[model samples]
Target: MNDGLAAVLAALVGLVGAVGGAAIGGMAATRGARVGAETAARATARQVQDQAAVDHMHWLRGQRLQAYQDLLAAYDAYSDAVKAVEQWASREAGDAGRRPGEYVQRVEAFLRAHMVIRLVGPVEARTMSAVLWEALQTHAFKLQDWALLVERRSGDETIAGAREELAPARAAMVDAHDVFLSEATRVVGTPMGN
Candidate 1:
């Protein structure tokens, strides 16, 4: 071959090698950028999911707190209603009208609150709530029966016997209330911590 022809062929070979190297580098850069983009996208999605889970936990904690507060408040109302009924029963028959409706309303409120506790519970709290609710109901019914006997102008001995029967029920209710409170406190962690 001529020396000039040999030089031309070598130049062509070198140019082809340079073009191929450029193409390979360009493809590698594009692949790296795509992988980087995919990685960033996955990280962002994971962060969003973690944030959502935290938000849900906060919301659930708030709900449980609210339910506990409501149930406690309802108990207060029911107790007040019972007191009112007892007061009416102790007075002269005509001094104050019967408060059966008020007592029933308070009991209904308590029941509704209890239902919320059952719904938002962590099992342990729910069990305690059930015990407390049963005690409350038993005491309320006994008190109602005694009040009715008083309204009927029952003998002193009969009324005293009925009143005496309330002691055990009242004690049970008090004990149940304490247990329920402790369980509720345990289950309902601090707002910031939960």
Candidate 2:
């Protein structure tokens, strides 16, 4: 009877040891799985963040390109209109001069483009654009005045004086355009046509 009782006691002790070992192993496995899941979530979050940054950069580049194109088109249109006015001023007094109203559309287009520049352009680019626009406006006003004088058969000296004033304004506009282009290239890389 004593030997039988000792064997039972030993068996019970072994059973408890097995149960404790199983519980410890189960806990270890659960902890490992939790750590793995956390690592995967972190990796996924990092990838998402990286992808968003890339998309934002692409969008910004496109905006800069569009702004540059709009500004160029506006400047070209305004310059052409100014040239037309100059041509009209050079014509004979008896010739029918172009009405100032004819150039209003081009001026409005330029202003709209200038607003776009303000919206999307870097600070330096915006400043340059404003300078160029101011110069263009000065020349446009002078040309308009000259056109009026030409239509009224004003003296040659007065027309010549207005024409002389346009020279510096044109030069300033050209210089501002160059500076704006340089700033754009620096910000957005080389544009089409250099």
Candidate 3:
């Protein structure tokens, strides 16, 4: 071949190689940048999700604490109620007989004590649920029926009636507490479940 034509063909081949190399490099860079961007976005999304979960848990804990404080106030009010009932019974029912008005006071005291003491078990159950709420849903409801038992033991057959009584207040409190915890637990553990 003539030198001129050979030189022209060599130049054309070099130019084509340069263009192909640049295109390959550009494609690689695009692919790498896309992967890096996706990775960063995933990390950011996960961080945000984790932070939101923490904030929600803090709010729920505050709610649980408020419930507990209300329960404590209820207990204090019920204590006052017991004292008032006793005094009233003694004054209103006192009489000399096989069972004087004092007997009514005794009965009232027994009922009050019964109601107050039953609170102990429900409080314990509620506390347990709160402590474990972030972990498991099933555990939070393991004692679902226990709330009814607590009411029955306090002498209320109907659920609403139990709420009217003091012991049933604690039982209902525990039930509410458990419900909140169970919801949280279900949300938290769902990913872990499957």
lDDT of each: 0.85, 0.79, 0.47
Q: What is the TM-score of each candidate against the true structure?
A: 0.88, 0.84, 0.49
**Candidate 2 on 98-126: residue-level lDDT in tens?**
55455668777878888887887778778
Clash number by candidate, in order: 0, 0, 1
Tens digits of lDDT, candidate 1, 1-194:
99999999999999999999999999999999999999999999999999999998877778788888988998888888888877787787667575465877887888999998788777887899899999999998898888878888788889889999889998998899899898788777655423
Q: Return the lDDT, model 3, position 122.
A: 39
TM-score winner among the candidates?
A: 1
Question: Over 4 Å off in model 2, which ranges?
Answer: 1-7, 100-102, 190-194
Which candidate leads in lDDT?
1
- Scanning candidate 1 in windows of ten residues, the lowest lDDT window is 185-194
Which regions of candidate 3 deviate over 4 angstroms? 92-124, 127-194
Q: How many Å off is the CA of 39 in candidate 1?
A: 1.7
Task: Candidate 1: list runs displaced more than 4 Å.
Answer: 94-96, 190-194
Of candidate 2, the 10-residue stretch with the lowest lDDT total is: 185-194
